[model samples]
Target chain A: MNESLRNIWTILKRELTGYFASPVAYVFIVIFLLLNGFFTFMLGGFFELGEASLSRPFFNWHPWLYLFLVPAAGMRLWAEERRVGTLELLLTMPVTAAQAIIGKFLACWAFLALALALTFPVVGSVYYLGHPDGGAIFAGYVGSLLLAGSYLAVTVATSAITRNQVISFILSVVICFFLILAGWEPVTSLMVRWAPAGLVELVTGFSVMPHFASFQRGVIDFRDLLFFASVIVFSLFGTSVILRGLRGA
Target chain B: MIDVENLIKEFGPKRAVNGVSFTIRRGEILGFLGPNGAGKSTTMRMITGFFPPTSGRVRIGGHDIAEEPIAAKKLIGYLPESAPCYSDMTVNGFLRFTAELRGMRGAQIDAAVAKVAGLCFLEGVLHQSVDTLSKGYRHRTCFAQSILHDPEVLVLDEPTDGLDPNQKHEVRQIIKRMGQTKAIIFSTHILEEVEACCSRAIIIDRGTVVANGTPAELKARAETAGSVHLRVRNVAAETLKSKLGSLPVAGRVSLQDNPDGSLSARVFPRDKSTRADLSLSVAQTATQSGWSFDELHTEEGRLDDVFRAITLPDSVKNRE
Candidate 1:
């Protein structure tokens, strides 16, 4: 167990440093921050809402923002390794494939978390403007991070499907797009107009919106947490299977 | 130690490696030689635990690779064919990462990285990112990573493929020195490298072992082995051929006219295994004929000839 942790930590450190070694990290952080500021202040109309809560303005844009950014950040997770032929070097080391996958996922997730954390000034802004439920704000942050994790995990699986990063990125975005539109209010209403009610509910059950919305309302329901955890676990597990199949082939 | 037993790998309907087997004890260097697509890389990958054999087992230091991959891999240092490294990392960082993955502590990681860097002559580029390094430097950086752990078994695939002549010599020297203590297997298309460093060599063709022997033994299988070549002045081609061919020790005598008007004759032994008496008999014949000769020597045979004889298509081999 201790050896496994050490292995995971070693891979994590290397992967995390890999992000910082190139200009990708800085550019990603800058674009992420700028986009968040733009959506929250200019488009979402945080001032017009006249509410102390960040659910509408800041947290609401997270799912869409991550739809693009998370895939971009995670596309290189396995694709670059395969393209550069480092996958052999990595797997031949004295570490399990699971350790390498988790380590890489956590590193990219932590980078996303850092970018999300950089939005702290907005949290401060809400606190300054009016009294707000700190628990609710914290819940929103957790939900946002989970949403990003789900997208990033899906990206990780797609990254292993091809050695080309662009293909991985496009695949992740298309998959996440369906996850978002499935439970989206307008899409559900459109489905209700022509489809059976059970089918609509069943499809929306796969959507991430309802789960993320509950977190924004400060309800840390176990079901919602389970939904996000399962997404991460399932996709990472798929990544490992795909990697093994590639080696086997 | 490295032990590969009846390893077989199939991708769909195509068998990449077919029931290939070999064992290397400590302090032995086994050179893997083969033509293109002969499964050398596939065999090395299986031994290093990168690819699980479809059937069979690879044991490293008594641990079965398929059953205990982590433990088995811990005992191996592999330099893959492409010599891959993380281009995003500096040489020092890359080596440090590999050392840490090998379970070294902080100071130990630093020391190991430094040791391999010096050994691979990577100190100059240790601070440079991998993408910026030359092909040879990149190859050495990956080679350094393989030896960072000082593994009990070392598998190198074309370790000197991209190296200049001097760098190739240096890498061969390193492999020779390390082979004194570790079980080592390296594959190459260059037959001279096998003669230069390998204690034993296995040549594979079409996914199977075709020949396994020492450099000298394999060379002795060449068609020219145990043949004598004589260049003499004032001897007619027909006269030399008939006289040399008539000798009881000689099998076939072929003559060529040199541009300088001297006759060059090669005498094959009646029995290919006997090389000692062929040269002496040719020398005696020349002296008796009162023919002055500029060159008279026995051919030790050549590795390339043997390699081609076994690997080339049957029609091509017959034509040669």
Candidate 2:
């Protein structure tokens, strides 16, 4: 493998193992599964709907679910390194800045991907009860992952800006909360007149729920994929910039 | 070899390292000596390519650190002051990870890990998590990681800080051993450590190099260097001063009364080059006069004295 890719893999290996070694991993995975189950069955009324569709119960709530869950995982991404002073150790190594950021960010994304995979039972239930649309379900999983990617990027970027994980978590949640809010129809419709048309369109287009809504219905639009990819790229780039600034500071 | 030329680091309005420059060759242990916040850490950081120098160049072998950091950093093994590492990792695991990061793998990684672990006396704690280890072991683990790949240049920031006497002695011994092959620089404010392990020492104050030379050369700069200390019995202070003053020695001779009713006198030489045989002459004088003496010796001076004199503020120095 090339040097950059090798460095990324090394960081990823450490981070993933770090999660499993700590109590936080068990806590996060358990809470993630429990809350996912509760929201899908009790709140979203999967049984009352009595349909094979996992959209309303599963994919529909991914944006809201990831708003809090993704940051919980991503808060420690850079904040822990800063608090423990390993950022200096890492930056001093032969690895470049991009490798460190991508390695760490991808590790958290992979952990979230594992957490999402645990929800396979939901898919099983939908399949057993009725012959559900595998194509749509696959698309939903892809979109849900893309949604989680966007949120993780936000958390990692914010975490890089500060040493305190609490501040990193809170800042990420607040930013995510607004981004999701812009997608909700009622809130945006009311503000459409008061807000400028272009500003409204930009917020609406950038909002997580709207971009994710198409995937919730298994549409697989290129525009939505583009949105999520752009967010991830821009946030990781910002993390590198912030890290460089800290070194000089 | 490591060469730093005109290295400067400015943190906002404050200059942390100012126009510092030095060169270190293989088998030479360079002691970086300074007080707290005196830019020793900052200078080391720039040399290791951890932080870029604002307006200078650091060349490791032939590669410039800023222009080719990856190539330069590959030749370095750095242990930052606190010895930072993943607290969650086992000692073996962290060492393996660091070895791999430096491009070691498989049996080579294991061999390097075992070598440094043994050299650093970390064999006992290899299985334990880093957070669970004692401060001494945590420090040793970091030291071991630095030497895992055995890079050409070793930069350690206060490698012996917070270690017990035994641990400090062991660490010094390892640095001395490694000094045979690597261009090593270890920073410390402990005056004796420079004399203990370093062949050449650089003393910095307020971001600038104040004195740089061999330990002997620096010690020679002290006011007490090459002075004669004579302890005599059955002699009054006035008699001893008048007698010693009559000698060919052309500087002040002061006497202090000792607790045993003997007189202790310190004699300065006429010039910076005090004769190495001054103590012999003083002994001859005491014997010829039949004056019994407790002790007589020539002082080579201590690095402690040299460090204080060289690093002291100009105002305080001038007042004395």
Query: What i-RMS does every model get?
Result: 1.2, 1.4
DockQ of 2: 0.72
Residues forming the 10-long window of minimal summed lDDT in candidate 1 chain A? A240-249
Interface Cα RMSD for candidate 1? 1.2
How does model 2 score by TM-score? Answer: 0.97
The residue pairs in collision within model 1 are none
Report the lDDT tens digits of candidate 1 across residue range A4-39.
998988888899999998899999999999999999
lDDT of 1 at B140: 95
Per-residue alpha-carbon lDDT of candidate 2 for residues B1-320, written as tens digits (9 for 90 to 100): 89999989999999999999999999999999988899999999888887878899999988998889899989999999889889999999999988878988799988999999999999998999999998889988988888888889999999998889999999999899899998999999898899989999999999999999999999888888888899888877887787776777536787888787888999887665546656666777778878888788888889988888877888987998
Report per-candidate DockQ. 0.82, 0.72
**Model 2: CA > 4 A from native:** B314-320
How many clashing pairs in candidate 1? 0
